[model samples]
Target: MLVLLAAVALTAGSVSAQTAPTQDRVLRQGQKGQGRMNMTPEQRADLQAQRLTKQLGLSADQATQVKSIALAEAQEMQSMRSNVMAGTDRRAAMQSMKATRDKYDTQLKAVLTPDQLTKYTQLREQQQERRQDGMENGKMKMKVKS
Candidate 1:
């Protein structure tokens, strides 16, 4: 169970990491030095919580709690990004980010039904695999490994 949670957390990271290159590309093309969408971390978290709610079919209370969890995670991730840029111990910061993501995964699991959790894990793994393949092949072709 612990191993599964770790994998889920790592897969979640990979899913988010997949978007980084696209965002970087946007910045490169934009005339502004820092081309970022005007989104507060809270707003971003709300969007994530909404996505999770749709995917997991969460109840109202669960959605609220998950949004709170997502908001905290977003704040922490921002801090981790700053620390990485500030020449803090990169590896340690990454580990801490992983741990923080794991904590969010654990909380989300508690709020999800057994079936929902199973589906969520599978979805994240599929996304991670898609991302890995896209990186290597220059196109996404979904295939589940045995």
Candidate 2:
């Protein structure tokens, strides 16, 4: 029974991890820029709690539960990302990310209603597109400067 619960938590945790982005270090052109690594876990947790509470209009209990879920997910995702980054298997790393994402979506459906879930999906997609566009713009600027 304990093992079953652990397995369920692990599965849920992995899914949460995909939605939560733990800030990581990015190195480009031999210059390393640390992004979002200065904050400790507690700090990240607090901020995330605040954000989710505001965004989702979560009750106190819901906020606490979601924060706990997000933290576990973030830790697992961070570990997986680190492992993939340290090795040469980029394809495997991508597969891991996809699996994690799928798990996250599944868990979300269980937690949120169809309406809330739809809003959540839209928000996630917008965030992703914004991040991608920002990165692309940065690269373009770099090329122009060079």
Candidate 3:
């Protein structure tokens, strides 16, 4: 009887351990979103400036200016994100966000050279395509061939 009880307890313990992660997953799934968007403006600016430096081979002066631009945009975006999370209309909020993004793109264009602008445009298109391809849970939508 002692051996049988020990085996049963071990089995139950292992089963609970395996299921703990699944329970956490279910809890997250119940939330309305994927995760928090709480990056600080300085952090966001640094990351964006680094990406621009790598992609466009920007000068130090240009990277500094770009970081300033990114910081401003990040501050605005953080506000927008908070409002959206607070139950602002998602579609309207998105439109406002896009308008803000376009304004930032214009600011970036002013800082970039012509060649850099072309490369930036291409990069943005590629990013948009990638984003569209992977929206909602990493499931890629397939087009059916007629």
Candidate 4:
């Protein structure tokens, strides 16, 4: 009876251990990027600069410049979002956002080497594809619910 109880306890422990990571993964996926939205502009900029540094093998100077640009862009975007939320015309806000992004891209291009720029372009395209796929999937899910 003691051996049987020990085996049962071991099985239960193993099962819970197997399930814990899955539960943690689900929670992580749900909360991913939500915390970033709550971060200050400087924090967001630092995060972006770090990501770019890793992705593009940026030098210290490049990383610093990127961080500066990212901070300005984040602040501008936040202001734009606030304006929209405060009943500003969305179309104009969108245009202004696009202009801001264009300015950012131009600045980024000046900083990156040609090879890095090419890689960055490819990365952007891949991200756009993923975004499109996600939107399509979301539309399909919405249709299924309706």
Candidate 5:
């Protein structure tokens, strides 16, 4: 009876362990923009600057510049998003958003080295692909549900 109880306990522990969230799962949830909307523009800028610093080996000056640009971009984006939510024409909003992004990219290029710019471009492309894949997956899931 004791041996059987021990085996049951071990099985229960293993099952719980299997059900526990992994670090990767947690990171994925965060990456899905959970809680992102609540962050202040400064917070968003800081996060972006930190990521760029890590990815591009940015100097302190460069990071500062990047943070400023990110802050401005974040604020602009927030305004644009609010405008769109308030019934502004989506096509016009999208065009404005694209122009904002282009301006931001130009500012970034001025701050980054040539190699860093290349790397940043690649990273942006990867992000775009991921976004497209995520949208496609969402559409597939919606279709499946229907």
Candidate 6:
């Protein structure tokens, strides 16, 4: 009887040990330079122009010109990135991006009329401010969690 009881107790103990609750920890990390293809430059420019038109009350002609400039910039940037991005090289990628942006800005300035350019510049500044605000908010959320 004693041996039988010992065997049952040992079996139960082993079963419980095997089935004990374990916490699952999942660590999510952001992917570098992912999903750029999903967002086409035409779509980006259209969205930007739409926002600006609604917010700044731009004329139809100005909006159309801006969209064209944006599309051209997007195509040029794509070409630049294709030529430059190789291996795991990040600095080269950044330099190419900067060059493309500078050229795009020059093209945009040339394409837009003076009044339109003024509004466009203001819109660009607002976009930058919005992006900065979003980053700050994200950081605050992370800090709150930690």
Can you give the TM-score per candidate against the true fold?
Answer: 0.66, 0.58, 0.67, 0.72, 0.72, 0.52
RMSD of each: 19.1, 17.4, 10.5, 6.0, 6.0, 15.6
Cα lDDT of model 3 overall? 0.84
Off by over 4 Å in 5: 1-30, 139-146
lDDT of 3 by residue, 3-34 (tens): 99999999999999887767345434433233
lDDT of 4 by residue, 6-78 (tens): 9999999999988776743543453365666677788778777877888899999999999999999989999
- Give per-residue CA lDDT, model 5, range 24-138, as digits (tens): 5543454556466777788778778878998999999999999999999999999999999999999999999999989998998899999999999999999889888988888
Across 25-100, the per-residue lDDT of candidate 1 in tens digits comes to: 5434442323323555686677677778887898899899899988888888888888899999999998999999
Please tell me which predicted candidate would have the highest lDDT against the true structure.
5
Give candidate 6 misplaced runs (Cα > 4 Å). 1-37, 80-88, 133-146
Give each model's whole-structure lDDT. 0.79, 0.65, 0.84, 0.84, 0.87, 0.68
The 10-residue segment of model 5 with minimum total lDDT is 25-34
lDDT of 6 by residue, 28-143 (tens): 11111233354577765775566556656667986887788778877777776676654546687778788878886887677566776788788779878977897888842443
Model 3 ranges off by over 4 Å = 1-36, 136-146
Query: What is residue 76's positional error in candidate 1, in angstroms?
Result: 1.0
Instruction: Rank by lDDT, highest first.
Output: 5, 4, 3, 1, 6, 2
**Sequence-dependent TM-score of model 3:** 0.67
Candidate that beats the other on lDDT, 1 or 3, i.e. the better one:
3
